[model samples]
Target chain A: MSKFYSSVTKKIWMSFMGLFLMTFLVVHLSINLLLVFSPTTNLFNEASHFMGTNPFIQLFQWILFAGFVVHIILGLILQIENWVARPKGYRVKAISEESFFSKYMIHTGVIIFIFLAIHFVNFFLVAKGIIGEIPKTLVDGKSVDDMGALVIALFKMPYYVIGYLIALMILGFHLDHGFQSAFQSLGLNHPKYTPFVKGFGHFFAVIITVAFMSIPLIIYFIK
Target chain B: MDLKLKIWRQPSAHADGKFVDYQVHEISKDASFLEMLDILNEELVNKGEDPVAFDHDCREGICGMCSLFINGRPHGPDTAITTCQLHMRRFKDGETVTIEPWRAKPFPVIKDLMVDRSAFDEIIQAGGFVSIATGGVPDANAIPIRKQNADLAMDAAACIGCGACVAACKNASAMLFVSAKVSQFALLPQGKVEAKERVQMMVARMDELGFGNCTNTYACEAECPKEISVTNIARMNREFLVAKLS
Candidate 1:
């Protein structure tokens, strides 16, 4: 147990949690895309209903929550340790030639955390009946939470849409460094495959950002 | 070449330091960066001023003794060379140059431009060696190491224990240095005997000494005089994780 508390071990945990969250984003974006592409169909509501009510996902939801909390906490702990490592800074700031996305991770992470808080309050809490009422609509004569309606309505507001876009742009930067960083931390780096991993991480970051951003933009403009 | 130098002037480790500007006239562009400093120190001594103290040995880049954060770089403006290897030609004649000691907490300023890097030695003491019975030198080719592994191990061994990686890292992480040390042994059969305990002990000592965690920024690789790859860091991470788990 004492061995698990080492710096490397902490990073390993962070990597696992971060990679898990990355997969969760894929599932989340796929379901959220329904708000734009399949607005007229019952697919979006059905998926939401399944996500909200399924036994497996319901259990997994807590695990997913734990992943986010653990990742954030570990990040903070590492950052604090990093701060203490350099008590006195240099008179001339050391210039960074590359990995620009890597430096401001904490700043980007804080923004993402803020966005997550607003997101949970607006959607997750409402769905859980903790904040506001969950809007309902009949799906095949079975009543379901109108998550699509709630999302579409929120996206319709220019302020919310703008904030979401900004938050996601920051998230893109965070993921840009994070994707390959997670793999590197997990000790998976190799000369042959590391270049590909880095390239793919950049590609993945852009794809996830653009895909998630398109939902809000399309909903605000066209829907 | 004539240049203005803003050099950190700390009398001792406990003294508050500040950048003191000086001018040197008619310095040859061919002089090494340290030789240029030597010229300034000589002039200072001629005027009964305290000569600036810094560390250097073997003027070749191998010893890794000379350290200066020159113009915001670990070893001046050049890449892949130590301070002893950096020439005055890299700088413009009239440009202002800044030089200071490595600024990590563990590497406290000893004087003007020399830092206490003995922390690195302590980390090495933790677990940087393989225990072998005292005997005659082993026969050549007796170990039968793979050529690829040998090359990789040599690359990791090239590290000179300079704190430049720590100096270069924004977090003052010694991961690149520690990783290189760990990799040098982990790749060869001789090192495999105690690789598990070696990695764990070294990393624990590194953390106990207040070195920052690697954030995978690759800054340490960029600024390393030895050009030690961050892959060694990845390998160290692998070795460390396996040690912790098993």
Candidate 2:
């Protein structure tokens, strides 16, 4: 039961990483929104180019990767530990409480993990010049790698669009629980303010999911 | 009242258990569930058959000794009472009712309708104590406390060490029980002295003893005979997090 080695500590770590990833989503969703909302394609290209080349962001990209890895690995371990805690189960099962969103956290998380892997292979590697070649486009009279074009091309394909929508939907559903649960795990619950937190969690989940969804729809419909 | 009982009969902790059907005729609905069981045992004994064994003491419900999973709910269909407090009227005449012991890894079946819940005692021993002493004959106002904190602490202390929370939990998590002890101490001035170490040790012991993590299901509150709040659990999560960080 040393400070860092206990289950409670593991929970604190999970909550910390989870909240950090949640904050990252706000920045990511805003950037991706340019693919749909901006009148000119240059905004997306410039945005993607800047994010790709910024040294500070590049350092943060590594921390972001570490965040995903730690959350997923520790999430799996904590899940396994919980399973071991209950070797025997009820004969006549009764579920009197717990919301559906909270109940399926692990399943949705695994889905999100699978989606992240596919997403990085498709876009992140290309943006980093690690996997595939990027098309060239002009932004501000300078030839820039057309990361936005790649996004458009990928979104035009029916399966990619469908998968993107599905993953975002699950992510939305997960955030519905994750936002508040993370706070609660960190012991942030209170009688006066928890309802507000839950409401904000709902709003955040919808906004992020809808924002991500708008990208594919706008790309396929407009261009 | 005539009733068809489907009771789990297990000989020992490691032995296989299953439901055995029995019919009891002409019993009064006024009889408590345990009293009905006594009648059923009398019939079996008279017929040269082995009598069913179940645990009960303080049938008034304070002891928390009776642990039965009756008709898919802990402590029978009645809310806020133990199995011994449930009267046969809750069941219909000629109805088939299923009864089983508390189901959890930490609570192993010892015999018919009884499981070993000593794991609870082990968890309590981990930190469920004040371990502080004040000089005798202190004034009542010596340690002035806020009414709200005192009342909440008393609420958490009302838990009867029942395993219903574990039985009702999907993961068999003892978070309610463990958190009850944590909350009781966390709110009290006396228990606050070693609060950090207390939460750490109790939660660690809980995890080590194979109790599941709390999903905040609130089933523990719903099934608790004493109606303990999951807020204590919220408080425990807060205490555990702060303790870990600070």
TM-score of chain B of 2: 0.97
Which residue pairs collide in model 2, if any? B1-B27
Candidate 1 lDDT over B40-105, as tens digits, reads 999999999999999999999999898999888899888999999999899999999989889888
Q: Residues B72-185, candidate 2, lDDT per residue (tens digit)? A: 898989899999989998889999988888877788888888888999999889888878784587688998889999999999989998799999887688988988899998
lDDT of 1: 0.91
Tens-digit per-residue lDDT, A104-188, candidate 1: 9889999999999999999899888888787788889999988888888888999999999999999999999999999999999
| Chain B TM-score against the true chain B, each candidate | 0.98, 0.97
Judged by DockQ, which candidate is best?
Answer: 1
CA error at residue B214 for candidate 2, angstroms: 2.0
Best by lDDT: 1
How well docked is model 1, in DockQ terms? 0.69
lDDT of each: 0.91, 0.85
Which residue window of length 10 is worst by lDDT in model 1 chain A? A1-10
List of chain A TM-scores, every candidate: 0.96, 0.95
DockQ of each: 0.69, 0.49
